[model samples]
Target: MEPLRTENLRPLDVSENLWDRIFTVAPLVIIGTVEGNSYDLAPKHMATPLGFGNYFGFVCTPRHCTYRNIEKSGEFTVSFPKPDQVVETSLSATPRSGCSDKATDVLQNLSVLQATTVKAPVIAGAYLYLECELFRIIEGFDDYGLITGKIRAAHVDKDYLKVSEVDEREQLMKNPLLAYIAQGRYAKISETFNFPFPKDFKK
Candidate 1:
């Protein structure tokens, strides 16, 4: 191989969030929690399955009510919104004001469904929903911490369900998944390809 371009890359500042320097594909999910007598919904991109098991984790700051609420209630619901529900997902991030829960106000406008196993609500029309109970909270990551939960129950929309008889690619093509491009961007992923791996690869 020839020599690579050394000057093409620029150094990033450590003081600021380095994530702003580049784009990353992440699953965008809405975290729902009980806030006192009311309910709260917040969209989180830095969320994922903790492992192959029935566990989920998300990054959140102490300043957010979602963290405090989950800390108190010990339960939360994760909703995987569809590509068309991006606007609804964005609305969930609405901030709260003193004596005025603007975010919950946004919730009133959206269709909300109650989870059978959890006390929190799940955003309706989402492809997937996970009802989780707080498993553990690992704090001390600067102002943010990782909140892990044990999935109590899960749900999937029928239209998006996988069928062995159906082509996976075609199934996705008909029901594209939503993706979040960090720092204010979104994508509708319909087309996909299988990853090639060495023979006898196992996870």
Candidate 2:
């Protein structure tokens, strides 16, 4: 006869690294810079960008005012940060912990572009800026939310993106994609692959 060991089980209350767990499962993470009625509630909201081509957007919990502002205002700017700006990008995720009143003070100071379609601002240093309008908002259980926006405009840096010169090897050696492993820690992703999924199974 053998006895099962209950000692192997530790108290499971909360996830040790929820962000890391989600990051591994999620294929991509897009930094969202927003402006709402009360920025005090959530200084900045950064989440994974999910949707189809030309209609790209993000899915986030509805609790935050950014979701409501986008629902009412119908626009937002998805900014992709530069590798060197990782420090400032990570600071955007930190809750209002400093003495700054405006949550976006640092973002603004980073030399960003003013969004035309929306009141929100886009990171000037970003290689691409996706301007979007709220197309649909899917609500579920407590705090669980899914919001989709239609890509209104795309501002890309002509210096970086090019077809003939653009290659995986070039992007690896020259370009660095910002990746969030944990909450604050970031890594430069030099590896990339192109895997197109079925139209019906789009994220």
| lDDT (tens digit, per residue) of candidate 1 on 1-203 | 98868698777889998898899999999999987877889899999998899999999998888999999999999999999998899888876673237545876788898889988889989999999999999999899999999999999998888888888898899999999999899999999998898899998
lDDT (C-alpha) at residue 160 in model 1: 87
Residue 201 of model 1 has an lDDT of: 97
Q: What is the alpha-carbon lDDT of model 1 when measured against the actual structure?
A: 0.91
lDDT tens digits, residue span 1-203, model 2: 88867787545436463444444422233334454432321223345456436665455666555565676667777777767866656555555543234455655545555777766676557777777887777777356566677777777776557677568667655776666554445677777677777778944
The clash count for each model shown is 0, 0
The whole-model lDDT of each prediction reads: 0.91, 0.58
Best by TM-score, which number? 1
The lDDT leader among the candidates is: 1
Give Cα distance to truth, residue 93, candidate 2, Å. 2.7
Distance from true location, Cα of 189 in model 1, Å: 0.4
